[model samples]
Target: MFRLVVFVASLAVATTTAAHFPWLYVADDSEPRLFFGEGLDHREYHLPDAVAGAEVWQEAIDAPALRLEMEPLEEEGFLGLAASQQIEPRGFLRTTIDYGNYHGSRLIYDAQHFPAENPEAWPEPVLAPEGLSATLRVEGDQLVVVILHSGAKPLTGAKVTLSNAEGGPGLSAATDDNGSTRFSRAAMIDGLNGLMVMHVDKRATGEISGKGYASTTRILTATFNYRSREAAKVSALQPLPQAVASFGAAVSEGQLYVYGGHIGQAHDHSRENLSGYFGRISLDGGGWESLPAGPPLQGLPLVAHEGQLYRVGGLDARNASGEEEDLHSVDQFARFDPGTGRWTDLQPLPGPRSSHNAAVLNGILYVVGGWALAGDSDGEWQAGAIAYDLCSTDAAWITLPEPPFKRRALAVSHVDGQLAVLCGMTEEAQLSKQVFFYNPASRSWSEGPDFPGSAFGGFGLSAWNLDGKLYAGGMEGVLYRLAEDRSEWEKVDEFQTKRFFHQLVPDGRGGLFAVAGASPTAGHTGSIERLDLVFAAPTARR
Candidate 1:
């Protein structure tokens, strides 16, 4: 006895329990197998001719797509076809199975299989052949799932279920308007295979296999390999010798060196709070070893090249703690030789400048975005940029064409022959997210993408270039990298602690080291945090 019931929008239900889903199991250096099952617990059912005969396609990131040859799977626990060739570890396997009609409705299943390697290495399919599909991305400790329909359209309100390969009813969530949802990567079950099953039931009359049906239901499943592993790790290292902000820091000979900074509370200035402390720590983990101290300075820039560190102009406070403070910028330019353990004076700046940032580009040092702080009076903003040839013995500060804006406390980075001056406090003392780029080759200034954060996120931001890629972060605590096309900034990851006026240096192992700063939660902290990009071990077959 079969009856057709009218299905409405509000009463849509998943076929998780009522119907079986097509699963594609792909392992590294192994043949891919296709099977029909109910969740992770395998089931053996007579294969439908339409589904068993469907073609499987292999799409690689760097190669052309190819049709795979398959043979019958006569195993007891699995009933389907196994590809004759082993799949490459860097691509995906996909196929469409038309399950004919059942229970007065037509059923179609689309499935995709992903390897357990780096998510960045995964190739995006040209189409949502599964009718319903999902893409996964990692942000810190969270796993984001984006559900899409045909033509890569975001499917709003789609119901998705997540389950472990071992077996369980699993957890279900509804996608938002963006057709995405987040799950704690730490809380998910670790195994060789994980399932994100999505179900959508559409109302329409349809005929399949000469059987009349009043509706169609499409099943989409994204079978991912998961393990409880840290894709990117953030851990607290040993705190600095003293908590300070506006400090000069650089890395030389695999050691992190810190020079001078302000040890006072935010917005508080005095000679007593100014620190002349200098120290170095092994990046591989060790206590900070003290070095001969420098002048009690702040608002300076420190850069390293060829195993030597360069400390540029900075401001030094002379008065005692109070409203009556004497602050003047210095024109002193010097370099520190780690091998000789001494500082050598270099040619000074054209004029005293503090709060500016500096970077090394092709054996040249470029300084931009700052002003001259004279006495207790307001600082004089400068729109000009200056550079010095580090490779020449007659090095001198050469003034370049004036820039468009005057700012301080920004971050500068050189990548692909361009010097980028990122967010800072403007002459009006307003925080901004604007970013300006100077092309040394063309001697022209253009604008890059504005940083991602609040208006205050730009002030006191920090940036570093590692192997041609630029990374920046600030008050938001979220790290961003310049897109490959250089058109925009894409988020890389996020940490819990948020602080501005801090510094980010390379960890020397493809990560970053966040040093002391004025934190909103902990106030002035000497804490050091380390972030590393890591990947989980290859997921083995269950």
Candidate 2:
């Protein structure tokens, strides 16, 4: 009886230690060996014996050859041989890992390896276990969720939470006798509504800590078939005439407009008079043409709206040679019409500022957060937000409530009737990942998601929106795509030349123009580039 008691104690200890998440990874030192361990860094984690019953199946993704029948590496830890896989002309090697309850589940994405000659429908996860499962369906304007215990039995009255994944308001519910609940349209963040998660936790059967010896946590994630067909493709463009930083750019009437910026690379300013030129390039591979110079401005915000281009608050001139007059934080606003090629003065902003961000939602323009001059010193960062009715003949600015925090040099994108302010520098001269969103309809500001794996305070940090998703980058020359559910940031593609201030303007064909930014070591690059998302399939609901 004593020997049996000791054996039970050891078993209990093993189960407790193995309660952490199981991570599946490919061993690089060997022939792509599959290893199921405790964390994403599998070297530091091994598969717990309690949930070691793992399998790799791609049959649901229709890639039978990519499925590998897993076997333990040495009697127990779930390491197995990588299957000699083959890719379809245009599909995924979507393998689902079944590591029992303790390991939950994982989906291995092998999409990049198989560049489809004719990429078509996106294959999704169809097979999974029910130890804890979630079923997602869109009914009317609501998303219905049903929690399951073993893929079939309802998990009644359990606590469930629903997260949009894009860093916004989350919802909570209690499952009914049918293990079902719903989140109305009001509970969801608007946009492409990417992958969402339904999580369940309760004192049900198992305990990561106690005698039940079963995993009490289960998550059901549904991909609801929102598909993106773009490969983060990037290419170099025609080099700029000279290096420039802190410039403004806009796309207007088939022409790419570039505004004034300094020649000096960020902090290493030479005070040279060579910069401060304005120009534009044709979308049809045309050369840059020197245009009528607006105010010799740098660090200004330029935007195109209603067939007109506008330049907002920025430093109009520098104290070059400590002699030339400088417009430290100019508040002047003007509109340039490409139709008539004429400049028109508009109502100036309430105050002078620089490094602020703007976005057009519906027909209104919003200017948010920046820095102003205070007693000849760069002032503290501002947390203000304001809106202007571009269509309103009044031309007066309406003051909105301030953001939750102060920021500068951040990026903002208006999508699906909402705007997300991205990462940027703080008043403390430090990088920040703080994000916030504004709803024009409700006129409310709320906290958003942090910039994923990125510091906001990079010299060239910027933000833009594409297809209801957010993209921020250039601080480190790596572009990150924000998932709608905001669960994680997708590092779509990296640029060969790391640069800040490079512009990403949509090309009207599911791609954008990436051009004219300064590289830290390479000075300024006029080199232009194209980043085609490559995916062109119409999004369909599952």
Candidate 3:
């Protein structure tokens, strides 16, 4: 009876051990022993499994259902079961021989253990491709690789390797004596996307003595589109020379004619050498052309009456005593015909004088305030203004009202038969701002508006009838326009440069052509500039 009890106790202990430790079959011949802890509820029993098999069959049941297989009347301890053909129940054991143990044995299913399903919890590290430098640029349609070496001597016969983004075919070249290699028309993918990569390698001699080094490997990736190509077009006009003569002159037919007054050499000296030169610029030929030396006169003032140009009295050359003298002691006048291009003597001014102003009104030439004698040292400037009617077969000078101011170099222009004398220099050689008007019908002088600025020596004063308004320019290039009532002077546009002793000729296109002014600094310049006369729109009175 004690022996029987020992056998039963051993059987119970063996069954409990088998329930805690299940046999895991990797293959038919391979069975790995495994322990089932608190959470382990299933065991996979694989069939026809080799040691290297990837998968296994599994069967899960309650721990109490495990059974121990043993011989009759045998005491059961821990059993190490092995595959054997003589084992009953087809190599599997159960507690009962009914459908419960059979159904549990057939519960086997496949379970795969492939690298633990690659742990989806952690992120993997990605490395950029190796073997290239970073300095690269797009040249034309290719990726241009430039390697700068740190050396004093030029690199020669050094090899360079270039590779594309993919580990595909690469190119190699030898550096020239300049340590540079050029790859022309090489195909490269557009760098707009982040997929493209380039590699460059270069070998160069170092600046240190006898040491040769290669450039660090460079890697380049495409980041942006290349710049587009541009086509190639002409380049504005140059400036013209400044004026060198007088202003307030006239242009008739095709010739721009200027007359009267000497442009002083400098402010330190006077410009009293009234032996002035007459100049003409040909509009058709496009330049200034002066006539050969003509008869010397004082003031050298000119007026156009009936297609004839009349030059009035002016001083001859300076005398031995360094004083100006009247050479041809007559109120000498010379007439030039545009058709004949010749000069004929005309009846001179009634009085001999220099520094007088002239204007033609109704076929008559008016001459005003100049020195009476050739060498008058007594401040003998006259206010007497006179007129010569060319309509008379024998045109002779007739006296009119005197000018309001004793001045010289005063520019005069005729508008609607009215003579307008602008600013001029006083006998003291100071600029005068006073202006005067003379009505040919009334034969009287009246005060006009004051000039805007002080007039200087070499005043190239000019006046023109532009849209029924009188426009004038002075020595300092200040242009002024008189209002319709002639009561006020309005400053207009100034010239680009200071113009004195220049001729302002009516352009006949509602503009004036300025020509030949002596620059105070640059001396004589024969440049011509045009001034377009613009009329203002009429405004209502306030």
Superposed on all Cα atoms, the candidates' RMSDs to the truth, in angstroms, are 20.5, 21.6, 42.0
CA RMSD (A), model 1:
20.5
Candidate 2 residue-wise lDDT at 291: 74
Sum up the clashes in candidate 1: 0
- In candidate 1, what are the lDDT values of residues 1-542, reduced to their tens digit? 11011111222444433455667876344788777666655646556676678788876422357788977877677678888786554457788777767667676778887753334333456575347767776656777888788668788886666765667456667789998987777556655454454444555567876888766666676776664432334333456766688888888888989888888556677787788988899887768888876688898988888898899999889888776878999988998888787888898888889999999999999999888988967988868899998889887788887888888999999777889889899888898788888998889988877787687777888998877878788887777778766778877666445667788898888788877666544345555666553431222110
- The stretch of ten residues in a row with the least summed lDDT in candidate 2 is 1-10
Q: Candidate 1's C-alpha lDDT?
A: 0.73
By the lDDT metric, which is better: model 1 or model 3? 1
In model 3, which runs have C-alpha deviations exceeding 4 angstroms?
A: 1-249, 259-264, 267-279, 284-293, 296-298, 319-330, 376-379, 428-430, 455-460, 520-523, 535-542
Give the poorly placed runs of model 2, Cα more than 4 Å off: 1-237, 268-274, 322-327, 456-459, 535-542
Order of models, best TM-score first:
1, 2, 3
TM-score of each: 0.56, 0.53, 0.48
Output the TM-score of candidate 2.
0.53
Model 2, global lDDT: 0.55
True lDDT of residue 347, candidate 3: 76
